[model samples]
Target: MAFTGRDKTWLRGPRAVGLLAAGAAVVLGLATGGTVTQAAPAKPKPTHTQIQLLSINDFHGNLAPNPATSSSGNVNGTPAGGAEYLATQLEMLRASAKAQGQETATVAAGDLIGASPLLSAAFHDEPTIEAMNEMGLDATSVGNHEFDEGWHELLRMQKGGCLNDGDGQNNQNSCPDPKNEFKGADFEYLSANVFYENTKKTLFRPYTVKKFKDGQKVAFIGMTLENTPNIVTKSGIAGLTFTDEVATANALVPELRKQGIESIVVLLHEGGFPSDPKAYNSCPGISGPVTEIAKNLDPAIDAVLTGHTHAAYNCSINDPANKPRLVTSASSFGKIVTEVRLSIDNATHDVDRLNTLANNKIVTQDVPKDPALTKLITKYQTLVAPIESKVIGHITTPTVVRTNDDSLESPLGNLIADAQLADTSAVTNGKTPVVAFMNPGGIRGDLASNGGAVTFGQAFTVQPFNNYLVSMDMTGTQIKALLEQQFSGLNGPEAPKFKVLQVAGITYTWNPAAAAGSKVVPGSIKIAGQPLVDSTTYRIVTNNFLSDGGDGFPAFTTATDKFFGGLDIDGFANYLTAHDPYTPVATDRISIGS
Candidate 1:
C-alpha cells in the first residue's frame, strides 16, 4: 500500500501506537477543530564539569628525599617528598581524577629549580628540568631564584639549548650528556608582571588558556613577588621591571573576559605564614604580604595558589566583592601537593566559586617510586658522586641547623658569617674587613654530619647560590642605620618583620621594646672589642647579593670602597677545610635587652 503524506504522519503519531496498544489514553478534540494532545518530555539535567588542579611550589630541585628523620622529609610527622615519590603521588591523583571524569592540570607557583642539591645543581639544573618534563608539569611562574643566573639563562631554561659556557664553568657541567642535550622545558613559564625596561614587554607570556575537550576554557596568570629585585642580585634583574601583582592581575581581567574566559587562577610566587606552621591543611590567622594581595585581587579570580614563604596553608580569603575565594600553598621541597577542584558551569562557561574546594595532600613515601623519575635521578647521582661524596670536613655536632632562637640568630647563620669574615681576612691590603654580615636567608640548609663526616654535597646544599664575596667600607653611623633598617621600612609592607643580619667580629645590644629606629641600644655597638665611634670607617664584607642591597639591606649599597673576592661557596668550603673538624658557633654575638 502506497502511503500518502497524511497517512505517514498518522502512522508515526501516537494515534497509531495507541490503536496497537488497545487501552492507551490519547487526548482528542478541541473546541473548533479535531486535534490530538500529548504531555511534553522532561528537560535534561544541567551540566557541571569538574577541573582538578594539582599544584606544588618552591621545589628547589630536591630530586632525592631528605633523610626520614629530617624535618623537610616529612609532613605532619609522615615521611614525604622526593621526585620519585612526588611523581607517583601525582600520577595516582591524576588517575583518580580521570576515573571520576575530571580533567587535570599540574602546575607550580615557582622555584622549581635553583639553590638545588649537588646532584641537580652540578649539571646546571638540567636533570631537574628533565625530571619535571617527564612528570608533565603544565606550567610554572618565574620565581626569585629563577633570576639567580640572570634572565637570559632563565630564557635558556625555557627555550632549551646548551650553555655557551663549556662544561666545568662555575663548577657546573652543562650539556653533560652529548647524546641528550638540554631540550628546555616542555611546560610554559608565565610571567605577567616582569618586563624588559626598553621594550616593556613581558619576559614570557602573560597568561595561558587551557581548553578542555568539551569546549570549556580556564586561564592561568602567573607572577612572582614585586619585590624580587630587592632580594635577588641587582645585576641579574638590572634591565627588567617587576610591577605590582594586584594591579597587573586586575588589569588582565578585562582582557581575559574579552576572550570569554570567566574562570581564572593565579600561580603567584609570594605567600603567607599560618599561625601554626605545622598545621598543613588549616589556615589559622594567616598573615603576610600575600594576604593583602589576595584580599585586593579582583573578584573574577577564582583561586590563588602561592609559594616562596614555603609555609603550607589552605585559606578562604574574601575577594574585592567580599566573596570567599580559595587560596592555598603547598610546603616546599615537593613534600605536599595542593589539590584544588573547580566546578565549571557548562551553560555559562564560568567557575562556580561557591563550590570550590581545596586540600593539601602529603607526597607520602609509602607509595612505590615512579620508575622514570627514579631512573633520571639515578643517572644524575652517578655523575655527581665523585664531587658530592668527597669529604670536605667534619662537623662535631650531628647537625648545625638554621633554626633561629628568640634573638633571631642561628648556629648556621653565625658559622656562615664567620666563614665570610675568615675568607675576606686574607686580603693583605690594609683595608681588611673588620666584620662580615650574612643574611639569614642565604643559609639554605643545615650542615648535617653523616657519621660525623661532612661531604662537599652537604656543604653545597647549605650555600648553593655561588654568590661572590664583596668587602666594603661603611661608617659606624651607617652601620647603625643598617641595623635600624632591619626592623623598619626597608623590608616590605610586612614591616615589624625582622631580618636580623648574622654578624661576625662585632657585637651590639638591641632593645626589644624600643622604637623602630632606636632598636639598637645607644653606646652598645662595638667592633674588635672597642666601642664603635660614629666617625670611624669600618670595613665590612658580605655576599654580592647583600652588598648590592639584597634582602632589604640598602645600607650596604652606600659603602665607600668595594673589593670583590672569591665565590661565597668556595670560601665556605675553604673555611671548613681550614677549621677541619668544625664546631657549631654560639649565637651570642647579638644581645637582646628589655
Candidate 2:
C-alpha cells in the first residue's frame, strides 16, 4: 500500500519511493490499518521544537536479565536486559520528556528479534515482537538478523500471524491457544535500500514521515548494512538486492525534501565499536563500516541511529559537508536506550544539530519493572520453563570464555567445532569427516557450566540458528582453497578482515600480514596428524550456513557429494550429554603469524 492522501499526516513523498502504503501491501505496511490520523493545525511555528527520540538495537529477545558479557556492556560492572526493566526505563524517559512539554517517540536500529534465546526462539520470536509492541516502538530498520528465518517470515513478523512451517514446529508457530494470536507490530519498519531482484522494488517502506502535532515532522530513512548478503544465508535473501547504504540514503534525500520535510533521521542498522567497550555513551576511537558510512552521508540527514555491530557509541561524525552529525548506537540486547533530544528550528524547518543531545541510558534493575512487560515475560517463561530447565548435560568446570586470543580462536568455538566433528563421525557410516569448522558469528555465547549443570536453554542459546550439519567431499586442494578463501572476504569492495573460523581435527599456521592468497605458510596444515596433500580427497563437515556459502566463505559451495546431517544444536547437546562432566578442550588447533 502506497501512502495515500488521506489526512494531513499522510504525506507520502513520491509515487516512486515505493514506501509501503498503508492498505494493499498489508504484509509490510503500517499497523494503523493503512491510515494515519490527523493532528490539529498549529497556530504558528515556534522557534524550536525539542523532541525526544529513544532508540535501541540488537535486542535479540533477552526476556530475562543477562550478565554484562551477553549484552557486551558493563558500565562499572552492572547487569542489564529483562524486557520489564527495559520497558520501565523507556517509559520513565518518555514521561520525563512529556513533563517538559516535549514530544516523544521511540525507534530502534533493528535486530529486535533474531539470534534470540530459547525463551523467544522456541515460540518463533512471537514473544519478542509482542514485547516490542508493548514497549511502544515507533519504527526501525531491518537488521541482518531479521532475515534469519527468511523474508516471508519477516513479513509475518510485521503483519501478525502464526508461522506454520511444520516439522516439530520450529519454524511453525501454531499457537496452542487461539486467543494468543500474534497481533503484528503497531510501529513501522523502514528499509530504503532493500529491493527485489526481478521487480527492482523495495521490500518494505523506504522511508516513513512521522508527523507530530505542531506541523513538525521528521523523515526516517531506515536501511541495513549493504553487505547483508555476505553475512546472511543465501537462501534467506535469494531474490533481494541490498544496495549501497550511502547511495541509497543520498538518493532519497531529494525525495524527502520535496515533501517539505527538513528534519531527517536515519534508522541505520549498522554501527561501530568504541575503543572502550564499557563506555556505553562515549565514542572514543570509533572504527568500523559505520564510521566510513556516516562520513559520506548527505548533510540532509540530521541524525543517524545505528546498530548491527552491537557496540554502543555516541559519535558526532562529520558528514560529506564536513559538518558534525549525530551518530549513535545503544549496545545490544535490552541493555541500553540511547536518548537523543533533537531541537528542531521551526523558523527554518531545519534541525539545530549543535543542540542535539544524545546519550545511552543503562536499563538498570534499580528501577521498577513494567507490569505489562513482566506479565508478558512471565507468560512465555511459564510456557517455556519445562523445556528450558531440562538438564541436557554436565560439566566439570564452571567457567567458560569466548574471548579470542591472537589466533582468533576461543574455547567456545573449539567446543562447537569438535562437537560438530564428533556428530558427523558418529553418523558417518564409514564415510568419515576428517575436519569441521565453525563460524565465529554462529557461536553466540559461551556455554558456561556454572553449578556444573548444563540446561537445554543454555545449549540452545549457544547455537540458536537451528542450522543443520552438512558433510561434503572436497579434495585436499579444495580444502586449502576453502581456508584461503576466508581471506578473500567476499567478491566486492574491500571490507574489514574476515573472522577466522574455529577448527577441529586440523592445525595450521598463517601469517596475517602475508599476501591474501599466500597467507597460509607452506607445509603447515595437518589433519589428524597427516600432512595435507593437494590431490587427496577428504570428507569435511560444517553447519548448513557454511555449505550455503554464508559468512563470505564461497569455498564451501564448491564441495561435492553433500549429505545433510542432524541439527547443529541437537548435535551439540548430544556431544555434551555423551561427555557428561565434560571439560573444555585446550585451544591449540589454531596458530597465527606469531
Candidate 3:
C-alpha cells in the first residue's frame, strides 16, 4: 500500500525503466516476457545459455478486474488485472522464450492467496491454486499471508481436498465442489526461514534447482521475512521458529554451490517501496527490507525476486562488492509480471551477472483471455454470485487502506476500528470497551463507493482475514503500553516504517524524533475526550490480529477478562449497515509532532 505523500521526495532517486503501455481503447489491457525494451542481442553460443524468469507476487487471488485502477497502475487510464489476463501474459512470455531457444520458468514471491477478494476466499482459495497450476508456476516462497489460516492449512492448499466441516471449522467449508474433490497445487512451495523449533529443521525445502534439458541448472533459494511471527496470527506460527532471512539464504549458498549449481536466484517474499508509483519497472531509490538483504547476499547469488510489501520495482542494486545485480518485483494482483533475462556463461556455468535485465510489464486486458482460466473463474464466480452481489451498505466517500506516511492511520483503518467499538457497544454486555484499535495491514483494500453503494464482495475484499473481534480489560497504563508498542520491536527506527494504527475512542500524538518505545508523546493520549488514567482499568477492543500481538503489539496479550466477539468482517459489515450513508471519520485521531 502507498504511504504518505512525503515518500515521493526521497523516492525519486532511483532511475530504472518505468515505461507503461496503455491498454487498447475498448479492451483496457497488456502482457509479456518478450522485451518491448531492447538491447544488442548476444552472439549465438555453443550451449543453450539464456534463461527467462517470469514472476508475480501478492496476487491475493484476484481473478477479476478490481473496480479501482489506482492500485492497478498508471497505464494512461485503462483497467488491468484478472487471472485470465495474467495467464495470457505468462503464456505469451513463455512462448516468446521458447521461440528464442531460451528455457522459461514461471514463479511467484508469495501471497499468491490470503487477504483475497470474495470469490477466491469464498472457495478457500482453491480457484487460485487451480489458476496457478494452469499458469505453469514452477515454485514460490511462503509469504506471511500464506499462513493466514495456519501452516497446516497452507499445506492443505498445496495438497488439496474438500473440507468436511462447516464455518469456524475449516475456512468456511470452502473446498471441493458438487462434482469433484479439490486437487492440490502442482507447483512447489518453499520456505527456508520458517522452521519447527523442536526438530531444528526447516518447515519446507529451503531451495529447489530447476534442471534444464540442456544439462544446465539454476537454483532457486526461497524464504519469507524473518519477522513472520510478528505479523501473522499466533496460531499460524504456533510452534514454528523464524530465522534471520539473510543468514538463511547465506547458509544455503555453500550447499547450493556444492551441488554444482552456479546460477543462483533468491526468490524472497520480502520487498521495499519505491518513491514513484508510476515507476513500476525501475528500481530507482528503492528502499525497504530487500535492499539491505540484496546488497549483503553472497555474490554467487545472481538475482533477488521479492514480494510481501506489495510494491513494484525492477531495481539493479549493488551487491557487497558494490557490483550491480538484479532485483525485481511485479506490482500485486497480476497488474504486472517481472521478466528477467539471464545469460549463463559457457564453461564457468555461472550467470553473466552484468548482462541480466529485468522489467515490470503491465498485464493489460486487450488480449484474448486464457480460455481455461476464464472457465475456472466463471465457475467460482457463478457459485458465489449471491454473496458477491448482495449490498452491504452505502459509503459517502471511498474508504482507503493506505496509511499516512506521518501518522500511519488510514480511512479504512478508522472505519474498521470504529466499527469494532460500535459492534461491541451495541450488545449491552456490561463490559463495554472504551477504545478500539485496528492494524493498518488488516485493512486490505479501499471500499469503493461505486454508485454510492457498497457490495458484500467489496466489504469482504477490505477485511478478508475473517478475524474475530476481541474485547479485553487492561489498566490505562497498559493501554499506553499498547500504543507505544506500535513503534518499536518489529517496526523500529531502522526497520520498515512503523505500522500506523487506526483508532476509535482515543487520540494521541507521537514524535518521530523520539526514541523507539518512547515515540508516543506523553500526556497526549486520551480516551473519550478525557485524560487517560494510568492505574484505572478500562476495557479495550481490537481484532484478533492485535489481541494475539500480531504486528508487534504484545501489550494486547496482557489484557484481563478477555471476550471474543463475532467475525471481524461481520462487525465491519454491521457497522456499515447501522451507519448508512456513512461518512468516514476524519483522521485527526493520530497526530505527529516535530
Backbone clashes in model 1, listed as residue pairs: none
- Model 3 CA deviation exceeding 4 Å by range: 1-48, 73-78, 165-173, 395-411, 425-430, 449-451, 487-489, 492-498, 509-521, 581-594
Candidate that would win on lDDT: 1
Sort by TM-score, top down from the best: 1, 2, 3
Q: Sort by lDDT, best first.
A: 1, 2, 3
List where candidate 1 sits over 4 angstroms from the true fold.
1-46, 164-166, 424-430, 490-497
For residues 122-215, write the lDDT of model 1, one tens digit per residue: 8878888888888888878889998888898899899899975566655678887788889998877888878888564688777777776467
lDDT of each: 0.79, 0.76, 0.75
Candidate 2, residue 40: how far the Cα is off, in Å:
34
lDDT of 1 at 298: 83
For candidate 2, the 10 contiguous residues with the lowest summed lDDT are 21-30
Q: What is the total number of backbone clashes in candidate 3?
A: 9
TM-scores of the candidates are 0.89, 0.88, 0.86
Candidate 2, residue 16: lDDT: 44
lDDT tens per residue, model 2, 247-311: 88888888778878898888888877777776666676777777778777787888888888878
Clashing pairs in 2: 1-21, 1-25, 2-21, 22-34, 163-173
